[model samples]
Target chain A: MTPVPDPSEEWRRLDRRTVLVTAAVLTGVAGGAGLPTVLGLAGAMPLWRAVTWVLAGAALLVGGGAAADYVRWRRTRYRVGAERAELRTGLLLVKRRSLARERIRSVDLTAHPLLRVLGLVKVRIGTGENAGGESTLELDPVTKAEGERLRRELLDRVRPDAPDSPHDGALAVLDPGWIRYAPASFVAPLLGGAAAGAVMQVSEWFGAQGEVIEWIGDRFQDTSVLGMIVVLVLLALLAGTVGALGLWVEMWWNYRLEREPGGTLRVRRGLFTARSISIEERRLRGVELVEPLGVRMCRAARVDAVATGLVKDDEDKHADHKTLLPPAPRDLADRVAAQVLRESEAPTGAPLTAHPRAARTRRLRWALGSALAPVAVLAVLGAALTPVLLYAAAGCALVLVPLAVLLALDAYRNLGHGITGDYLVTRSGTVRRTTVALQRGGVIGWTVKQSSFQRRAGVLTLTATTAAGEGAYDIHDAGEGEGLAFAAEAVPDLLAPFLKPTGVRDAGVETRKTRG
Target chain B: MTGENAIRDEVRLRPPRNAVDERAVTWWRTQLLLTTTVPVVVLGVLGALLQPARFWLLLTAGAVAVAGLAATAFFPAWWFRVHRWEVTEDAVYVRTGAFWQEWRIAPMSRIQTVDTVRGPLEQFFRLSTVTVTTASSKGAIRIEGLDHQLAADLAERLTRITQDTPGDAT
Candidate 1:
């Protein structure tokens, strides 16, 4: 996307980038220093010093990055003199991407605690006449007044008091500290990243008999041979844990599951970083109320979507990309689902026919058992991994075994989603709860699958695809009989438009009721 | 009037059809033979290089390689599967996929862009393939099975269809 050339626009844009660079550089240097300090204790100090000196030299080279960013940022300004919001930015290589006022879809304002204190808010404006190309363009943090002005200017035609968008809804509840500080959330990351950082810090120790460290250090530059290998492995694990925490934290805060006053419903969440999103009311996608029997006992169900992008933490299916919320409260899930789905009742279709009693669920145990088999397989995967496990020490192995088991148990949960008529709602999640509000209009297609095993168990899995693109937003698992029935029967009713070569719908047609 | 007539001439000149990169089919067949079979063959011959002493251990990698190689044999067939595209009154469906079914359907209305691409291999083959990416998902639905001239003709047809805008959702 190009931005127009405003005289000095580059400098202003770079200024914003420069500040972020400063923050990153400061964090990296500080974060890097901690590593060497710890590695010194691991009996590799002398070698570590040499490795650090090289790194410190490299950091010096990038010292001007922050300054460069500042220059670029200071030069940028929105030339809103007339018909367009001329976004002129970039430095050495310039770009100008302009979005006319008429193209504005919605204006969203977001602020973190830091941004709030700075009296600045970041705004994202969704535009583009169709789903193609940049759906949203970001505006650098602006003061509240400027943000309001921009909002007013762009959305002049839209109802100012729409009241039911993602930003303004009864469901937009800020999370309390208790949910944020959940022991599972903090303990895992603290133990993981800190222990890893601590372990690496010792690996660079340049102390007595450091010749081996010297040899490895001398082998690679731009990287110490040992440091690079060790740090990269740690980073991989760290990244994975970071991702898991991201999902955990995102579910914890700004966790709003609301039925907007407008016919659409949205579930917006994030912990440190948040997202403000609104779906087209008529574009509610196919949904599933999955009851992973194991997570059910724990009262947790993961509600993801069949979205097109690469996230939302469910297994990658075009149908199930975004996890609607971590886990939310039942009463709240119902209210939000009812509103979004236009259902008279909130979605509560858990294994209603099969397991009449909630407490006595074997499915939870069954799901847990299958999930745990992978752990055993991983453990038995020894030949390729013997060196790694041998370092654990036998006693630690005994303790680690039980921890994995307990966590697996906690993950067991049961949930379901059903589309009674035109509206589709799903109930899921354990520790936190989630219910998705989907409609026939949002979905693009239907999919039905039944394993020979499922037929024997009187189960059928249904996956519904939506126009949301890839991942779970496209497909999701549902209870067998009900799921397939919904797929072959209910889905055709919902997505009948796409099925026709000509997408023109019959006039005066309302939503078709659930054939299921 | 002059520009319109010239464009009309170019449109009419587009050939009816052409075929996908036969070289791509040939190259894949060889790559399949090497990566899939080479390692297993080496492991089978060497004791230390072999997998565990379990009953089917030696055969496991080799078995997987064989299945993979078998699948690779059909790579060209799979990759160049879409030689036929009939835009019907009902819908546009292209049959692809090896095991699980893949029938890409793009109604005339949702068609966004009609493009042609030639990867390095296809360039060598003097082949340009057509891509009909719709507003459905992420990437466009590409039909590489078309012959080069046919690809150009189909692209023009698609472009014309999109331009017509039939008024009532096409």
Candidate 2:
């Protein structure tokens, strides 16, 4: 079905609801600005006068903003033509932007809580150029239905002769059971810490700091310090769990991944602030299965699309909009990845070849060294300061040593690399394990690095440099001979011309001997 | 013997020779001297005015300035000798660095943009710097100290090559 609107139609303005949103926003700003004055005048001035002043301030701000917004809404106009999508905006400067239909890569729609209530959404049409904001055209407060129609019309450029078309069906949808994994994420502890800090900060602000501390101390009066500490930790954890669950629900309440008509993979999600992201099938390279330490322990993983032109707009948001599936069962993540790639088998699930033993040794030494540095510093400080510091140093070492060893072992276990069919899979890390299944053809070059230590150990780091995804996938500490051979085999003739006949030594004995 | 050993042996040998402009040494020395002189002069004047007792500091500063100027005059010539770039049909090779040498090879097809930049100092010297930007996160590779005409010609040639080759879907 043709999704294009009538070409004869004139440039249309945004939804009328934007005026109300602007008024509401201005009222909020006025209230925030006048709060201090209201509180200061609470005692000296008459109550009605104070109220009148606040009301007048709010009314004036809202009236001015609403009038300006009305003018802006009147001036701003957008037209979706057969060849280009044009947006003419700016009150005085008269900035006009038009993106060619063929160059449009993605059409993303976002609706905040207010916009959602008003049935309006902001649409950002991108050309996938890395030229910052210049490559995108924003249409704020468009009707939800109009936004959807625009998305479909702009992205309906599927190849006619394609053998296997994109499956026009829901690939993945949110499962309520996945919410259990939400609190299990790293964000839980962070939220817990933030909650603890907020409590202290708020108490201090209200001049009730002593009362709160005294109450806390009284509750733990009969208990030992250790017991009280444990209780506080548990309380923080509980608070964190609730915050994480609430955040998860807000972000992924009705998350749905669907293959829309015309080879577009669209994700519609969020509860209060709904988001619709469309990724063209042709730009997709592969999928990444990320399993953080906590998530991996729970056998849950998140899936991200490794596609070109999916540049992250915000550094603060984890996973950004590239997340295909929230933290779920590893098997489910793999299945969703397979669906995204339109392949029978998920490339990430395959057993990858392990790196040499020397690599593990190197990791262990580094981890141990890192863990010991702090301990050594504490010991030195203890020696210089007091005997009490020695106890703290001992306590630190007692906790850190084992944890460091475990992480080192985990990192070693996670290190592996393999090539399966048209994809090369590389897995690494301990705290945040990532298994990337990258397209072999996407790789532009191979970088081989051998530090003085690595060279002595007869190992090198081989990086498959690509423009898409994380820019580069590295197979760390592969035996020198094996890495070169792998590089040569992966790209055939690319590395062969540089390699000498003497370089192709067997991987096992030399790496082992060098470590000894 | 393994193939990797042969490759490593070849890499150890000097790469292809395509030296930068000879005047680059004088240009670099002048730039270095100019940068160093201001800071040295400022420190010396501040010391002389603010703390007359620390006049020994001024002597030390003068000595450092002399040493810096001497190094600046000598180091650029060595740097100029080391800096080299070669553009082949398939790839562009650039070798640079003073203490820790770096050799970068970017495939011709990976190049997205080629630009020629000339600063006021470079304009005075009739020299230009050519930058080849690839899609790689490693950032652009710059080949400085080329004759103005040569830089423009190289930029044009690289642009033409990039256009002719189909860009990788990145």
Candidate 3:
């Protein structure tokens, strides 16, 4: 902002509207929870008395939350100094934390509906170091413009000498057509199952569990049991599809991926609760192409940044903070991934070297072993108990065996590893296939694992350990020679000291050729 | 068997240059003994006091004791033979594990921190464990059962070496 002279040593308090935001959030929480409390209490006391108690509790909850946040607002003070960004807070046990200004990698702005209404956003300044809370300063609620200004100032950097600007600026904006992929994700069935569970849970809370069950039973009374089950599953699926569509809209309505002037890739999205996430280009190690089973069948994939210090907090572990694009067409995902990494073509889309036959055999064995375990147990119980149980076990085998085999084959087909330019790529998994293109320079270490069975199978797992993304990406069940050669090729001399030369290839010859 | 032999011949990870201190075997034995004895002894005493008439309880305790004794007799030496560590001018190489082997290599430039840990049993045997941590979460190389003085010197040397060559250790 205001590029006024000197006077940068000033401290600033959080926006006073933080208290109001807290109060509103608490009211919503109390309202949702209080209705159930009143219903439960009504059974033990007069309805009017229960209502009065609930109202009193809600008032107390809101008042207490607002008062605590007010104290917090009073205690917190932050300053963006020339060399360091420091924060001082805590009422009883005072704590002061600071990050060297140059080390601050990201300045994110998030505003839920309440904060949006109040024109305030929560600002999180991070060093992109995974040292927990010590490396981050969170301002609960600051003016929206102040948040934006802080983000710009903190992330502003001197442009690199040779700016690669071809793929810069508004890399990909939201395509409303992408919404079709929402129902194809695994989230749909999960949401459907969750919806069914919630219905039962809510009805139970209202002490209408029996009535709800009776009502369902009465509706299906004329239908056969199999027909009823099919109809109910269909209804749950319908509910799930609608829920998934709504969730997709809420999360990705205004999705935009932009590359700013200073090499920062920004993802701005969300409808009611807007989030602006920034990832410094220098911190990015690579990109991952994620294809959940259903999405892959639809020829769609999601792109996630493989970068240092993009870890999600424990509370939001399920949130994909690194996602640059929602599920889109495969080629679009690849293009966005390529642009994200500033490469002409995506490394993840490179032709990968398939793993040896042993890897397929391994997957087949595992799939069959897992699928047969339950069948064996059922068969044993059936043999010991009843003929009816035996028939059920047979039916189970008939359904599970082919499905498991298909998945095993699919997983086998997905196994691949390759190198494209500066990135080393690996792909695996059946249900949730992921192709990770990791910058070879970012690989810090290598771990070679050989279980007794794996050794017997003539395969081993090679893990490229890096500080980015998942910390380690595995090339599973690779041929021993192929894996070692790939490792040596990927990082030159990192794995050289530990590898022994084969008889036919002299170590010196190998070195001379490889170095050349 | 011929195919297995051919696969084994394809690529091999040379064992690291140095073996851990000889006392590591005894230290590991003492540690494993303590872990196994405590539970077995507790079970035996509780069973004798509360269910003395239940002969099966005593038999079960006896069986556990035999198994523990056999493991204490052999496992430590087996593990010691497989556990090795070597630090070169470029990187740190380590080979660990007994049944399932792991070979790790982390370049000197990637090391973030160097630490020395001494457990009570390790201290009793005058041994220390030197841990070299890299930015990667999975890249912590542990060189266990070194002479206490040697471990300290190693950690100090690593710290000095990595301090001069680094790009934020990432």
Candidate 4:
């Protein structure tokens, strides 16, 4: 028999420099963790003794981490075979997992600052299944060139006869002027709140809480309590603005949206950490125009792609892989959205059919109920316990009632739905109004819901079930006949077989049927 | 006149044509009995052992048991009347829930997988639950309490039909 070539020879090891990267990372981690430990220990014991203990612990931690990573690197072997990309990892358990080559949908490349310096990138091969980590193959710290090659090899299924579209190249790029919109976002207030909390927490950590409080009290001693509070709030807001600006830059620096040759839209961004996220144009169902309250006031909107298989990883829940463009001018957003979907005009910008008046009444009721709930609670407590709470309750109602009513009216006004060629569009929400244009063809199912109360009101909610995006987008509180008709028209035969044309019957029967 | 005309032409979603196997009512009763009474009984025993003098806790447990028993007696039959499933050549239709009613329709062309699941109780009752999954996360239609053999055949048939159909089912 001919000598059988070793099967293990075909298996490739992870980069040898992974050990170095691991060591460096471990050192950084040790330093970060050791400082706090040393500080805490220094108070309990002598400073030099604490320092020496921490240094020894840090060395041990780094050594242990590097050794573990070295063992992991030695054990981990991956092979991109003819049919499957297989990875065999773990020491004792020896977990062997494989993903079919054809099923692979994305090959993202990311490089943090350290990885960038080392000329290495992490390659994440995903099947785009919502099935957690099982469907992903992660090769950490692969050479940048290797990552690029792997990405190309996996995603190189371009149709030979694909027509060259006019908008095939760079679709959009970062504009420095966009930073002006950063502070206008809700992030500013959130960051400001976080900054205030952090200041208190950090001062407490350093045992300087009392001193900081005294200093603040001294600074504001000249002013009245109200004026002091106002100044402090303004200062916090200024700090928040700066923080939000920095965060925005770090997140969206060098942002570029490009439509590649093989019908893929690639988004490349980040400053210290580079990310290359690719979305196959075929998987794109539609686009959403998101206008948050503050952003809306500034006449700007963000465009997000509605694509299948863009599930967030369990480990990286905050990673938003759907956004194609940040908050920009509304007209520019519409234009970019149109270009992204390859339509003459953005479907999201199309005039929508306004929801019925009863829908508005329902929202008003809900808003009034919500606004009244806390006041009612306070009033009850005041009657039972203290009279001061009654005054508080009244004050709250004065401020909250009109605000709730305004919001209710805005929400009611925002409710709309319509069909625009191949896309069925729906818009809703007030604080964060979202206009979704979903591909009519992408809808695979429909769910129609009607509560007993809704039956009385002659309204229903129609949910278009799609494989893409949030899976289901609702047309809420529409006239029963109108909603059903819309569903029937949106997807031809899906809902037709279930519907029966009948003369208006007794409402009692319908309610009883629902209850039963 | 046009508004009235639109209302006149409107169609309402009727319940799906088929009801599940009748055994589902008994199966649901048994399941609910186990789920509800187990906790109440455990709490009653623990209360009696730990604090024999605290009579109100035992009374509370007794009240919960009575409520659970009432629900076990009536809810299943009501649910049996409401829950429905019908598979056509084009789509799978289902109507489910009691107070907040819902009608779901999933097209065959978009169906991703079909499975027959038999839990311990279902197996004991010789029943099966046929789960029809579409690409959409919200579009998994479960037809509970079908005859085991019938569910298997349905699952097999669906698998064959879906295999013949093209596209990524997205």
Candidate 5:
């Protein structure tokens, strides 16, 4: 065992290069602010005078920011002792924070292009407590080497006997070919819609909506109405594809998932702003394979770590850092999941027991009801108002009914739960199908919910509540008996002792009747 | 199958009935009436004073407040009858909710912390509420209307059980 280092020790300051980075950011901001003023003064004022004014403003801002940053850097000190990692900063107020070493669950590193150029990275050491800013200690602008060392030393929990293991290797690396799935994501169409909305908003803001609409109309004047609509849609799709590709590149460029000498799993990704998220293996509860509709159709899925102490905060910059694997071939995703769990086979790929047809009926009814609401509203409007409204009603019915039915059927098909060795797998959803292979041991409690409607349908929602991941994995619309039985079997005595005898027997009979 | 049936029968055996102190009903009734009536009375006065033309509104509000006060006074006795909790060697069973009855079972091993809280009203009534926090995201399970001494005892017992049970890393 390593000796516990002294806590009451001298605090070390961050690298001086932080001042340069701070000054550069302030200069950029000043330039952006001064641009409009300079442009407005182009003809009104003397060119040299205007230019000098802008230059002076930029210099003053940068100079003041750099001086402040220098003082901040000087005052900001961090120390990683055996028991705790402490950070103290602020020139006037003097704020101090210390995270117990045992409670330290994650040490994430981030470096933007500017910081990267200067070989500096920002390190955030978190205790994994869900309590806002109080749980994290940030050390901004540390040297690259120092960052790497801190990551290793802070996360070093390897067994002394085994200095290196075969598992200590790059589990997954960025595949350029995976970029094709970027445009295939559902985000593409969403981005396209957002772009169109943005165009309208900007034009409205500038009072150029009429001019923009006229320009579009003139461009498509020669085409037939149908052809014009098709062309517009295709153009929107093209723009969407480009936007999705750029977003994908920015978020996932150079993505690498690797296992260190210790039991830490590190995910390094991003292009302009690189991020390194470290998760201890012991804290990892499981992995979730996410297949959004578009990506699923493309035979691709994303992987996420379902680990304890990886609390998502509103202010957390690396909110999406939970993504362990980028959208890739489902086969590759499965393999990476298995590798992360240190298992020979991925639990997600295991065959799951399908839910009863009653579940399907429920989903179908819900889908039809939801889809018909708009149609019903439109039909009422059409009857009361113009015939043009009737056409819209017809259009809505024609598009929504079939789509809703398909989604409902797909959701029914996806509803399944199974246990494979140490993990219990539960699959659900239509738009964003998720198969979570949660560790059975991780589940601390069970909640069985049966509403009056559910009781009439002889179905119940059983949730395995754990401390990690989403905190609960639910098996929705399962036959009450089957769900109870499964829950009892999954965790053994936990749920068994709570169920009434007659209730269990009746549920068993019901289960048999439904299955038969 | 027979062993399973036996276990089921054992499960069906009603959990130990530990009802809250009898004074809790009086406390709850008083608190409920005070909370509901004070707000309504103020609103009624404000309505009559601010808008004399809507004096009928003030009468209507008073009537509704009376009805609400009556319901609040009566509901506490009914709630006191239904709201019960039992702490077994291995689990804590709390049965709550009025119209939609909910029975929550939290395993002793999963318990992270057990706390006894006394609000101003509860303190005045010499009562405390026990909160058993588990690792589950559904949040803590609270058992209100307990004698202060009983609440302390329960909290201590739960804490001791949790400490004794291994594999409670959470």
Candidate 6:
């Protein structure tokens, strides 16, 4: 593939991080170097006396600068040459090393407010170990579009262009709700910060009111702890409301993801130093289609993919960001689910993998959740000893009522895993009911587990592994041979067009099924 | 289909360990107790010999020695016995829980790296270990008691898979 320079390159220089950091350094130097002459002309304090503080401050600034420049020089530049990506760095003791690009695994990018202001971001490329694993390179202050551009360059040098890019119209258009990941991210953090602030304010306010109470004590008793608690609770409700509203306002910024013409997802966000990341459909490892308990009842779900690389555009700030499918209308979960799971290719072929709602797994989650009942019962029993214990037991029961119901319901909803063509997908979650997907070729391995009783029931839970950890993409329950069947039946022999740099396997699936 | 077959093919670890060095430091309590108590036992033994007026001093050293020895011997044994792994064709399986019983596996395709390690104890026992790391979480799966050649071969095989796996997004 003859390399095509990125169409987005012009926008790269538009970042402010490069400008700000450079400007800040220049400004500090100008002020420090120019100060002596300026003070000398004014003849302030004895020139000798003035020279001491001015010289001292100047030395501190420039001396401090030598270290700063070295650190910046170290983390700032990374060049991926023809065969290798060499990362050279260090402020004092400079170092340089290059990993074969073919050995490169995943590249991560994160952009924060400061980086956004500077119009720059950070990018990290992880090549598993030594010359291969965990060889990391960070590029700071790259333009907003540069990360994707670098990824594109790396992709071109490594493989042919991705086959199923969004331009092919193979992927369904998704509507991203800032509410999905953002609510928990933005709202929870906001409320938590506000709550701490509120506590401090309440204490100060009450302390100030104490003087008034001292005079009014003859007419009315001092506000009791109960009264103070009640007031604090009311304040908490007020704070939560205000915090939520503020977060909603912050949510209005550009947090959109466009499905590019090349069957790839391009997600861009951040109000100032806008960050954009590209996720190829082929790199979809596993989907964490979360239907959080609250969202489940509301019939909504947030589908997040266990994508291969981090968005390099934002890493100057958010160094570790997962490029994902934004939340869409719940009804659309099924619509776009197949493409996200690698089941839909315009070319003719059976979808290789499976979905969670497969036959045997329908009851798998229920069995596992019900198994927790004994432990919960034991704890409940252990709490019922004295009068205070009885009240505590009652309180715990109230909490368990919702916990058990939610778990059981969520389990029942999540119960299913079966082939969805060459793409293996599992759909589960209470709030954001999800449909997770992964290409057979994208599968790293398979896991089978059976509890003692499950062994008795003749059932084993199977999870299809992908590069994405914790969120194994698919879990199925089937007859013993079903595991091997998944590997033999689905895993792709040919790599998908634009397979993830390090995620796709060139070998047969390994079925690691067993009872623990 | 039988439990015996499952035992032989026990899916001991989850596919692709999320972290490198994924094993929990379960022996930390035992290690902590032994390191702290052993020196105290030595001090007590010396003190008892120097000042024999307190006959019970010898009993104190015996008690510490008993706890330290029990922890040291049983701890490493339990750690090794409970932690087991099997890299089947599809996934690297691990079964690591001592009591509650949890099984995990990482796919060969998902494995980021496979490492072979021969710890001081394993070398003495003529055994080797294979450590598997994945792109997922920081957790890793280490399978001990394999022959040295087998461990090296498995690591080579795993690295090959990781290298060839083709998610183009990297």
CA lDDT, candidate 6, residue A507: 27
The per-residue C-alpha lDDT of model 5 at residue A11 equals 63
Q: List the candidate 3 regions with Cα displacement exceeding 4 Å.
A: A1-7, A315-318, A505-516, B1-8
TM-score of 4: 0.91
What shift in Å separates residue A331 of candidate 1 from its native position after superposition? 2.8
lDDT score at residue A392, model 5, on the 0-100 scale: 97
lDDT tens per residue, model 2, B10-78: 223135469999988878988898888887888788787877646777877788799888889788987
Candidate 2: list runs displaced more than 4 Å: A1-9, A28-37, A40-50, A163-168, A201-210, A224-227, A315-319, A446-450, A492-516, B1-45, B49-84, B95-103, B119-128, B137-139, B145-150, B167-169
Superposed by TM-score, candidate 1 places the C-alpha of residue A496 at a distance from the truth, in angstroms, of: 8.4
| Decreasing DockQ order of the candidates | 3, 4, 5, 2, 6, 1
**Which structure among the candidates has the greatest lDDT?**
3
By TM-score, is 4 or 6 better? 4
Q: Compose the digit string of candidate 4's lDDT tens values, residues A1-516.
A: 122365323687777778888889989998888877887888999999999999999899889988999999989988787688888999999999899988887888888888999899988888867786889899987789878877877777867777467778998998888888899888898889999998998787677889999999999888999998999899899999999899888778999999888778888988888888888887899999999998999999999999888747555432467889988999989989988998888888988877777789899999999999999999999999999999999999999999999999999999988888889899999999999999999999998888888777778888999988898998888778767877788888888878887775434323211000
Which run of 10 residues does model 1 chain B get worst, by summed lDDT? Answer: B7-16
List model 3 lDDT by residue over A1-516, tens digit each.
234465357788889989988898899999999999999999999999999999999999999999999999999998889899999999998889899999998888888888998899998898878887879899988999889988988998997565676887899999999999999998888899999999999999989999999999999998999999999999999999999999999999899999998889999999998999999998999999999999999999999998999747565443478999999999999999998888898888888887878889999999999888888899999999987888888998999999999999999999999889999999999999999999999999999999989878878999999998889999999888767877888999988768886773332333321111
True contacts kept of each: 0.02, 0.12, 0.63, 0.68, 0.27, 0.16
lDDT for each of the candidates? 0.48, 0.80, 0.88, 0.85, 0.81, 0.52
lDDT of 1 by residue, A1-516 (tens): 244575223322311433664556565675666555545444545766656765665466455665665765665655554466666667666667677765554565655545555556666666523443344556666665566566655555533455434434564364463242232333345556665665555643544235655664666567756778886567656664665455556545666655544433345555554444444333345333333433344343334433332223122121222444443443444444454444556554423222111212334555546655655555555436785544443444566556645543443333444555565554444443444445545444333333444434433334444445341232223443234334444445332332322222342222322233
Question: What TM-score does chain A of each model score against the native chain A?
Answer: 0.55, 0.91, 0.95, 0.92, 0.89, 0.62
Clashes of 5: 0
Query: DockQ winner among the candidates?
Result: 3
TM-score of 2: 0.86
lDDT tens digits, residues A1-516, model 2? 124365424577788788999998788888776775676566679977988888897888899999999998888989888778899988889999998888898999998888888888888899866665888888888889889888888998867855355445899999999998998888898999999998987676556778999999999999999999999999999999999999999889899999876888999899888988899887777788999888998999999987777746673384277888999999999988888888778888988777777888999999889989999999999999998889988998999999999999999999887777678788999999999988877776665566667767667777777776676778888766666666666665455555554532344334321110
DockQ of each: 0.05, 0.23, 0.51, 0.47, 0.27, 0.16
Model 6 chain A: ten consecutive residues of lowest lDDT = A494-503
Error at A197, model 1, angstroms: 5.2
